[model samples]
Target: MEGHPPGLETVTLPPYSPELQPVERAWNLTDEPLANRCFESLAEL
Candidate 1:
C-alpha cells in the first residue's frame, strides 16, 4: 500500500493459490508460443 492512500488495506494470498488470481487463467495464451517452439531472432519471433 505504499502508493495507495491511507486507510486502504491489503490482503495477502497464500503462495501457489492460482485460483485466487484471475491473471493466472490467461497465462496459457501468453505462454503457448514460448512453450511449443523457439525463435532464432526477434524479427522471426
Candidate 2:
C-alpha cells in the first residue's frame, strides 16, 4: 500500500464553539418540529 505519511494533528477551538458547527444550528432549528409533532411512520418523520 502506498499513501502519504500520517501524523497526529492538533485541533483548537474557543469556548462556546458550537455556534460555529452547522449541525448544531440545524438541530436547534429542528427542535420545535421534532418535539411538538408526531409521526405516524418512519417515512412521515
Candidate 3:
C-alpha cells in the first residue's frame, strides 16, 4: 500500500466555470477513437 509523506496539506482554488476547462473542451471536440477502431483484445485497446 501507498503511504503519504509528512507535511502534506490540501490547497483549495476558486471555483471556475466548466467552459474555462481546456480538458473538457478537448474531450468534447475529439471523437471516440475506440469506437471508430474495433479492438477485440485488451492489448489492442
By lDDT, the best candidate is 1
* Two-way lDDT contest, 2 vs 3, winner: 2
Better of 1 and 2 by lDDT: 1
Residue 5 shift from truth in candidate 3, angstroms: 12
Worst 10 residues of 1 by lDDT: 1-10
* Residues 1-45, model 1: lDDT tens digits: 598789898899998899999999999988987887888999998
Which residue pairs collide, candidate 1? none
**Of the pair 1 and 3, which is ahead by lDDT?**
1
For model 1, the superposed segments whose C-alpha errors exceed 4 Å read: 1-4, 36-45
For model 2, state the Cα shift of residue 23 in Å.
1.6
In model 1, state the lDDT of residue 33. Answer: 73
Query: Each candidate's lDDT (Cα)?
Result: 0.90, 0.75, 0.64
Which ten residues in a row are the worst by lDDT in model 2? Answer: 1-10
TM-score of each: 0.58, 0.45, 0.30
User: What lDDT score goes with residue 39 in model 3?
Assistant: 77
In terms of TM-score, which candidate is stronger, 1 or 3?
1
Candidate 2 has an lDDT of 0.75
Residue-wise C-alpha lDDT for candidate 3, range 1-45, written one tens digit per residue = 236577776555459756655577776456566456777899877
